[model samples]
Target: MSDINISKLDAASADFDRKLQKLLAWNEADDRHIQQTVLDIIADVRTKGDKAVIDYTNRFDQRHISAAGELELPGEILKSAWESLPAEQAQALQIAAKRIRAYAERQKIESWQYTEVDGTLLGQKITPLDRAGLYVPGGKAAYPSSVLMNAVPAKVAGVGELIMVVPAPKGETNQLVLAAAYLAGVDRAFAVGGAQAIAALAYGTETIPAVAKIVGPGNIYVATAKKFVFGRVGIDMIAGPSEILIICDGGTNADWIAMDLFSQAEHDENAQAILISQDESFLKAVEQSIHKLLPQMERARIISASLSARGALIKVNNLNEAVDIANIIAPEHLELSVEDPEILGKNIRHAGAIFMGRYTAEVIGDYCAGPNHVLPTSGTARFSSPLGVYDFQKRSSLINCSQTGAETLGKTASLLARGESLTAHARSAEYRLKA
Candidate 1:
């Protein structure tokens, strides 16, 4: 394979900030045409319901379904798919599901209340959504791991039901995805996808139930549809291309670091993979390894394009400088491949998920490592987080006041409301006050 020209940067460069911002920039701006198309699809689904979903599925996925009933996959089919998987695949799926579920269990929020001296009960009631929808990219691209990552969390959160939708283009369905869904406790599965599936999940077709929240990843159309349906139903996030930033201390194997960068770059042409190291020679060694390994990759072209477009290798003065750069970039996956990762991790202020130590490859976190692989991307990690059980739960403030407590709080409320010129609010508070 020819040498790949990944970007090289120095923290001490005179225009380092300018160059860094350029590398980190990703435009997720809405396209007017796509937005209009998604709006039209959503409107159609809302108006025609089952017929619209069926029509869209048939047209988009090349399926010849005569009825909406045919769109819903039977539970028995999912079970059979799980039963039919190869022993190795089945065991791997089980392991991954178990790990994901165990991690999700810890993230579950419970209802709690505390009584104050005035006999006023104030706390929070954590409740799961009634139902959630999971969208897995289907057809030629299969992601069984996505099923486990998304469904496991909602199930752990005690979401009443979990519905999944995947498009089977050309009447082709991925058995692994079906098997994973069955294992992950998906209550329902549908053979439909794209913006139409998002529409069905958001508005509820005759055959599909409206989900309280939607989670998982999808293509551009699906993402745009999610944006359009935000007010109608809760959404996990509008994810950007996969990203990984590795801060290494020149000690780990260069080949390992190269492969780690390859993992995210292989996701798509736009995916970003970056490495920052205080040792300049280590960065060169990884670059050499990248060239050596590129030819062996099945998705070499995609990886190469990704690395050329957005990937980088940076020279930092020290680990502290690396941490500073990492916070600014706020990548979806941050790897501290150093001797003392825990110490370095303490200074990290941003990142969707942090993979600590030389042995903790970011890929482990993608599957059986127990953390949700679905993460905020395009520097959004500064503000957002990974998909977890908390994403599936809703919190309601709990307030119960005794008569005396009400009287005491009412005076403050009445004064505040009256000052704000909300007469009805002030009057309501006055009614609760002792006469």
Candidate 2:
């Protein structure tokens, strides 16, 4: 096997920032053709409802379903899938589900209010959506983890019903995914996928019900459909490629860091894996380890391609500089593989999820760890956050004003409304004031 070449940069170099930016750039240009195609699909689903969904599902997923009813999987099938799983697999799923549910339970928001001096009540009310859609990718890979991550949180937030849609290309379904759906307490499961499934979820079909919000990950078509139907129904953030940034102190095992980088790199050609360390010798050791390990990976070609395209091994002057670079990247997954990971983690303001300590592999968080693996990518961690129960629950401002409080608030509202030249708003507030 040949040596793998990865990008290397010195943080003290004059053009380090530019080089880093070039490496970090991920342009998700909206392909006009995809947008138009998704638009057509959405419009068709809206106009024809069940027929459009069935036709698209047949064409795209290569299925031969004659009726809309066939698209909806029987809940019994999910249970059977769960029951049929091997004892080991079933036990693993159960354990992961329990941990995820426990974490989500803590994230659930409760309604709270406080009384003011005038006995006016003011606070926020938290409510879950009536129904939510979870889109799990189905063609090449099966993501049972996606099922648990999206569904458990919604359930914890007290969402009334959770609907799941996974494409069954060639009329074949993954047992693990169905088992996960059953385990996660999905209210309904659909066998259709792609933009058609998204459209059906956004606008109710004869068999499928429209949901208040949609979550999960998908391909370009699914993402474009989500973007088109944003205002019509709430959606989780549009995700980018998976990413991992590891900051090492040149003390951890070189092979461990190499495998950690490969964990994200093997995701896809676009997935990124980077390492920042102060030890030049350690960086070389990791590079050697990459060459030694790449050949053994099942997806070696993919990992190699990803590392060549987006991966980096940087030499920083110190750990602080490493943290500074990490802040700029705001990666989806940041691993502090140093001795004092907590201290370094304290200064981290951005990053979707931080895995502290050498033993804390990012892969653990992807699976059984108590946090949601669905996270903001493409530098969005700077503002966005990981998928959690909070995403499933929404807040409404609560206000119950006493007569005196209304009079006092009315004066302020009247002035603000009048300043904006909204006579109706001004009069509406003035009407609530004491005569």
Q: How high is each candidate's TM-score?
A: 0.98, 0.98
Steric clash pairs (candidate 1) = none
lDDT for each residue of candidate 1 in 250-345, tens digit (9 for 90 to 100): 999999999999999999999999999999999989999999999999999999999999999999999999999999999899999999999999
Over 303-390, each residue of candidate 2 has an lDDT whose tens digit, in order, gives 9999999999999999999999999999999999999999999999999999999999999999999999999999999999999999
TM-score of 2: 0.98
The candidate that achieves the highest lDDT relative to the unseen native structure: 2
Judge candidate 2 at residue 79 and give its lDDT.
98
Error of 1 at 315 (Å): 0.7
Q: What is the C-alpha RMSD of each candidate to the true structure, in Å?
A: 1.0, 1.1
Q: Candidate 2: global Cα-lDDT?
A: 0.95
lDDT of each: 0.94, 0.95
